[model samples]
Target: MRIIIKGGIWKNTEDEILKAAVSKYGKNQWARISSLLVRKSPKQCKARWYEWLDPSIKKTEWSKEEDEKLLHLAKLMPTQWRTIAPIVGRTPSQCLERYQKLLDEAEAKEGADLDLTGPTGGDAGPSADDVRRLRPGEIDPDPETKPARPDPVDMDEDEKEMLSEARARLANTQGKKAKRKAREKQLEEARRLASLQKRRELKAAGIELKGKKKKKGMDYNADIPFEKKPALGFYDTTEEKNRQIEPGFTNVHLHKLEGKRRSEINEEKRKKKQKTDSEGGVGFVPARASQLNKLKQAEQISKRRKLLLPAPQVGENELEEIVKIGFAGENTKAVVGETDNVSSLSDYTPSSTGLPLRTPRLIGGSLQTPRTPLSVRSLRTPTTERARLNRRSQVVKRDLPRPVHVDELTIDDLTYEGSEIEKIIDLEMIKLLKHDAIVYPVHGSKLNSQNLESIESFEEFTDELMNQAREAINAEIKITANESDLPEDWPKFEDLTGIKQCQNQLEINRNLMIKDASRAAKLEKKLNITLGGYLVCYKVSRSSALVKKTLESFEEVEQAKIELDSFQSLNLSEKVAIPKRIETLQNEVDHLVRREHELQERYATLLNQKQEIQLRIEDLFAKTNGNA
Candidate 1:
């Protein structure tokens, strides 16, 4: 990547500066260096850049003398600063600081101080043991009594080569074995992953290879026929085979069929009533059976009862029956009780029995009164229903088919425009002949149409009526009010509790105004007026209460400021001074408020006393006015 610097300097040049920062400080600290370089001067930035780059400078020239001295120091003392520093031409401290570590390897090699020459010194340089002598107070070497350590066996040329070759082979074999094991494991894992991928692919394609499903329509037999065969050796009889009728023979078929059906129905009914032989059918109880047979033979009994309607009972006191026949021979008659003698005197009597039944007897039947038929019954209606029927007939004869009256023409009756209106009016008039039908009493069960229409018409015009009612109501209220005065105990507007309350409130206001001079002045100023000195002095009992208040407030504020200053002078985390002055001021304010409340209560009590005196004065005036 190219390092591009297009802006003002390294600080503004985002790309080049970042690259330099990364190269000098490694990629890890590049961000921090770039941030610092953004604000630092270019000289400071260049110095930091040079310091980071200078330590890692590589010198490619071979220092042959330095190498020879380095190897020489690797022998001799092997780890001594004094023996290694001169050979490197550096300080003893620098030798120990930088390269004394290079001399330390000689202590690990066997025969480390032995000169590599023949038994005596041949051409090898001086051994470390023969190099120097020490002065007094320096420790001398003890040689004669020292035990000689055995020399390590030296490797020949071929053996050294073999050892080198073995080490190389071992390293190569271990590396290859590790790589081979990793490759085998990777191959095994890849094969496992491939198997899983194959399973997923098959699952995605919806293939169930392990078990195949059966196709539809293959499980059952479809060719079986459904027919019933005749029983062996069975054949149709001649009646069943040849008794078939031709078509269009409905009457013949029905007549032939009904005869057999009637016999079957009678057989079914008889079977339903059958009794066992032991349980006394006709053969077991012949005597009782003959009695029943004699009754059936001597009397002709009918299963169905004849229906007879009683004559209509109309008048209770009158004896004559009003028999009115319609033009079509439809007779309407009113009869009383069970007597038919009047009908017998008429021309409608039967010749066989000389009875006057309503209809003539049948051709072969006689008009005989059967004394004992299926049952006997009495006259069933009560006296009250009979009386009500008599009254109902009177109403019907008086009101039926009547014309309407003019007073009874409702809005619904007015729907027709011309002749129908006259018809409805005539019908209404006919309906009104009975006094009970025309006028309904207020206590009656119902009102007639005239009364209902009059009521509805009165309600329809109620707006002016309501106004008149309101005027009458006001007049009555005024008269009632003028006839009586207010009770003696009732309060007047001026003497009521509201006036007393207002006086008490004004007194409280005055007391509150005087309780604290400064507060009173503030209240007065807020109310935009000045309290006279006399009132202030009379209320607070001091001419300089305002001054005192001002001084107190100033002192409080000064004390607060001083305390704040002291608190701020101390450490920020430290506590404030104890609030002794503020507590004292708060206690004083509470006491003043309590005094204000007490004064207010006293003022209210005085105001109540004044109100009582005024009430007594008003009562005396009322008594004088009444007596006069």
Candidate 2:
């Protein structure tokens, strides 16, 4: 078997395909983008984009300032092209290449000067471009950072297949969603025709079936699906419903009597509706279920109702008795000097003559609370749904299709009675069909919350039914997968690559966070020092509302004391007297702290690595022992 490697200088076809893939799937989906180009990996696709093909890359000739800044930054942060690239407004590869080119020019200049003084060779060595150029049969090491070569007139079969596959994938704008919608539409049309045919057949046989117009399909209690209307003219006709044409033709015939599709009938009806609507909006059209909701709304708005208050509580007799009690209390208080308790003047009932309790004021028809004597309205939403679920479940159980044997059952042994065996076979077939319905859902049916909850908690099934379902699912998957044309292991590879990239990013971010934390501490210290003098000076000069500022300054002072103490062990007198020496000492102290932090970080990393290796060794030993 011949071994084939999958990367080299990118061709024109591959480059174009890559560009199209990126536009479709985007830069983040490098695995998907690279799948179009058989020769490139995800990393290569990403590098190609960032290093050369990206629109954001500055491909123009390098300016003098850029060169100077590049050299300055390069000297300051050596071998950190990745860090310097963003600051230089370029990619890492571009920065490195430019830096090397400048160095080569300087070296050549020095060599020219040397050649002037001493004897030189007759032939000049290869130029920088030629020196780096790949020989025939030798792969280009950094092909991603180079421009794509021109494409040949004829493409290889594999390349053609890949192109076609990519084209097909991209062209399918709707994908699974479109396929689902199409299936739903077909199912709906089939259901409508089936219903119409049934009704026609019944009428033809002289059996006038009178079924109520339902708002929902199968789940009759659910809310009707309505098309939302745009805000419109006065009197609000937004509640108008779409009308359907119930075909009146008795039979299929020639000329105008020829059978028309449901869509055609609807289109004809719509044209008539438009004509009626154009005639100054005078007509009221009814839905198939019943009258238009707009008519009901208009009627409700037009009507006037009597103010019917809650059935009059505290009738004439009760009111009269209450007034008499109040008068008696006042008269008794005025006549008698005062009771033992002066506050008792308000109470006419001397514990014995307390008025009899009357029934609570009649409110809306709801059950009253026992202790509080108040009517609490029930929450109908969940209760109504629960009721519907119970109703539906009962109906489904009661009205399940009576088992009529379609296939004849014959047993050579005749171990069990024929009726008993037939009944069992029917039950198993019913269960199988139920399983199929759950697994392969119908497009026409809509499930409410009750159905969804019920689905989640299913009844027990026989092992035979489960096995049959499993086999069916597997068969379906196999048949569909043949047309998908994807490598089976590619998805696993993508997952691995994603996890690796994420881990790499986490490490980079961790380092950045550590660096930022240290820098922030330094900045915070400097900030407090800079602002500390202002607060002190202001408080000394001013009197009004200076406490707030003084407290702030005090807090800053305390922080500064802590920071300074932590900074150095030397006392004020022992510290360096000279300004430059003080500065140098601070710099040295900072350098040592930074070095310590870096060392600690490295130690932690090495510790983690050690643990990982130890675990791996244990795993290996366990596996070896198991094998033995």
Candidate 3:
């Protein structure tokens, strides 16, 4: 006996079967309906229908109002997604996903504001994206909510059997009662035939027979049961006693056995309908008997599908020259290339060109970033030859933008550079380190490994050290990883795919400083290019003081500039120093100006927020008063 997991993305056959089952069993009776499908359960069927397959579900773009309403409702009801789902006109999963996406976007924007986006380029971490996007390897919990992939051309034996069984079960028109009645009628006929045969046999031997009288129930041969007596009319009493007349079988035609063929009836109806119409029933183009008839025919044609003719063996240049010579009225010779067997193609394509006709032509791009280098624990096995057989369908992805790196962010991960949180964390780590040093003095003692063998020879020292080690082991130190310099070191990972993940960190290269400097230089050049002269000016101002006072200046131009009277002889040294002093002052002025602008902006933002909060409170109070 084998146990199999039933749920995943649905295939075309399953979808079609589900639709048929739903039609027969109705929207309710899911348990009974589920019996028709081998893989899907009752709950999954119900969810698949309601979440995606149901006609009522909206799959269009969410409007501005819907987004606003969703956000407002989310704020009011927090994690009550199921309750909010109906109001939002979305499935619970959709509502929850959308809410999470919105929150991620907001957090990303906030991180950008705090100058913590990108790797070392003021980028805090990976930006927000559809984090809930399905990855390969792992099964989708709600495949019912996604579109079904088409079934392969060659289906399994089990699938065919399930399809046939479903067809037969759904096709049965008679109910339980109808079947029982038919069975009883058959039994009665059999009994009548048996009795008739027995009588014939007895009569043939010249034996007299009497029929048994019924003690209970009606005797059909004698009289009708539960008959109502008709009231006698004065003139109709003699006629009522007369024998009833039956239709003559001699006059009945073969066609009259079943009056009016269905085709004839339909023809008459169509003729009548035509007579009634001003220009017949159909439009300019003749109407199809059913909608999508052409489409159905085309689909049938596609199932057998045509293949494009393989490329002909010919010399293209020679052919062209021959055609040109023929046009020029000169005798030309044709050169045909030798042909090879095309039965086994190395690859498949519509035309026998290198690429397929259906494949999209990729326009070459102007710029591309180099792939990031990654650190691996060890080398993996190289991939083998590509598979020629059909592969599993790719998981459906959302239309949302894909982020470069998939990062697992936490509250402690992306705080402000000089924030209180950072300061507190640093302080806590230092404290933990100190405590570890004191309590676990074994670590400090191990720094002097030369004393290890000789320590036991000194019995008094050994006893003291052993006692301290025991005390350290007994010490109940309650500390978290954040509160200690020594990390748990459980190897962080980037959740890339469902099964495979990348290490969050890269391996340290030998020329680490060189690589770092190169990347920094490239990043600086890019920033300068994108941001313009303002950043360059700011950087120049900051580094100007250092530039003016280099080691060479301390060696050569210590007092030379002041000795030559470039300006007035009076206070020449002060004059030379005045420019450098002015530059330093100018740098200070720039910083002060930037700081003042920031403070003003922050102050204004606070005032606006405060005003809005006040207004909201007043509105709430007024509403409460009105309700009371």
For all candidates in order, the CA lDDT equals 0.53, 0.73, 0.67
> How does model 2 score by TM-score?
0.28
Where in model 3 is the C-alpha error above 4 Å?
120-131, 173-628
Candidate 2 — what's its lDDT? 0.73
lDDT of 1 at 62: 21
lDDT of 3 by residue, 1-628 (tens): 8675677788878888888888767899999878877888899999988887778788875766788989999999989988888999988778876777778878878878998665756543434453455557767777887889979868988789999999899787568987999999999999999999999999999986998775786668987878998777756568767867666866888899889999999999999887767355457334544545888987889897678898887889978976775654322112322234331212222345574345343468443443345431222223211221112111112223221221222334322356787776665443333333332333213223423333333222243565686577566454332544444332322223312322222322435667999999999999879888776588777688688778667767746766655555667778789999999999999998899789779989998999999999999989998999
Instruction: Quickly count the clashes in candidate 2.
Output: 0
| Native-to-model Cα distance after best TM-score fit, residue 489 in candidate 3, in Å | 99
* Backbone clashes counted, model 1: 11
**108-225: candidate 2 lDDT, tens digit per residue:** 7987888742434656556777787778898778888888887776878887998898888777645677789999999999999999899999999998888877644555355445
Which regions in candidate 2 have their CA more than 4 angstroms from the true location? 1-3, 114-121, 125-130, 173-628
Q: What are the runs in model 1 whose C-alpha is more than 4 Å off? A: 1-167, 175-187, 207-628
lDDT of 2 at 12: 77
Please list all clashing residue pairs in model 3, or write none if there are none.
Answer: 116-123, 116-124, 117-123, 117-124, 118-123
